[model samples]
Target chain A: MPGMDMMDMSLMQACMDACAACEQACTVCSTQMMDCGPACMNCADMCNTMMRSMMRMQGMTPATMMAMLDATVAMCQYAMDKCMEHADHSEICRMCAQACKDCMDACAAMRESMMKMAS
Target chain B: MPGMDMMDMSLMQACMDACAACEQACTVCSTQMMDCGPACMNCADMCNTMMRSMMRMQGMTPATMMAMLDATVAMCQYAMDKCMEHADHSEICRMCAQACKDCMDACAAMRESMMKMAS
Candidate 1:
């Protein structure tokens, strides 16, 4: 609260929505097969976590924030790779990959805004 | 995959472990009351996400990673505050606050490590 003067409710809301949607998409995607299931499950949980975290921004410092973003981006990347392995054969994988990408983008945007504000 | 050889599995594992422990603590904490319930729910979800994301490190940029960390730290702060409000009277809240503090510290360490590696 002390260092967060730039908390944009609208942007944060949209990002959270995207994260929730991505989590759902990835959850459905991961249940498709064992190959991608582990990563998808991980990503789905992470995205959901990320969304809920954003919804409650009353306490945070830049260090903790960046770490979480780093983890999220890593997860999305892993999920994307796994989903692509099945994208050519599965509509669900394709959609899941897209969702991962979207979540990554949204998280990045949110991070950037926070960084600028904090700085 | 291209952007993630800096991942130290041991450190990541430790951080994830801490996250899991914090998640479980917060989940248990949240069931204690209506006062801290909402924030506890949010924190528990965020910690789980943060932990899972760390486990999957194939896709991440420093930027995305930072955003997530920021979100997580913020979440922990909120959770701690909520827990503290009940800490005087509730043992669970006191324990939950400790978990949040530990998570915040672990995530910070991990973030710093990643930042140094990325740089």
Candidate 2:
């Protein structure tokens, strides 16, 4: 429930950047109409939501932040798993998988930092 | 990969409509700086993605559709949970919660219809 005053801006910014990249990658991958398309679309939406939540910390509590992070991680993982299936044949899927991995890691780091700050 | 030829257009259209309504309501509620803001924002993104995916069913498989529906349902449930906490004091939250509920129901129905058709 703390304001931005208690949060690390750099970490938040990095997470947002990662989310944006992942969203873009997923969006492009979705257009390929592969079996991963729906997962890609889901990941894109989740990443965008995660990015915007960080931007609007005034509207979030630690609880909501944790929930969003968990959901983002889940969606990213699902997307990445699907993309990895065709990664060898599809350049876009490979890129999307990497982006999802990066975004998941960034979100996890953000969550850890928030926990440490709260404690 | 059965084309939209086999889909119930009316059900898909209704689901898309619900998703759009939910997205708009959540977007509006998220700007209110309420504790539900993060969840509302997340719901908005998910709803938009769901609507768009329906519009572009060419890119989706039944498996992906089921996964997306699950994700959308989870998000809508979370958002509705958060909004209910402040519904008595916030009209926007109340409306957003209703929209989320409607979208969730619509998505569930669509999923059920898809299952029946597949069978």
lDDT of 1 by residue, B1-119 (tens): 34667666777787788789888988898787657776777778887776766666633445555556666667778788878988888988899899888887777777788788888
Please estimate how well model 2 matches the true structure, expressed as its whole-model Cα lDDT: 0.82
Candidate 2 lDDT by residue in tens digits, B10-76: 9889999999999999999989987888778877877887787787664455666766677677778
Report the CA-based lDDT of candidate 1 relative to the real structure: 0.75
lDDT of 1 by residue, A1-119 (tens): 45666667677787788789888998898677657777788778877766765766733445555556666767787788778988898999999999988888877877788888877
> What lDDT would each prediction earn against the true structure?
0.75, 0.82
Residue B31 displacement (Å), model 1: 4.8
Task: Name model 1 segments beyond 4 Å from true.
Answer: A59-63, B1-21, B31-39, B50-89, B101-119
Say which candidate scores most in lDDT. Answer: 2
DockQ for each of the predicted structures, in order? 0.31, 0.21
Give, for candidate 1 chain A, the lowest lDDT window spanning 10 residues.
A58-67
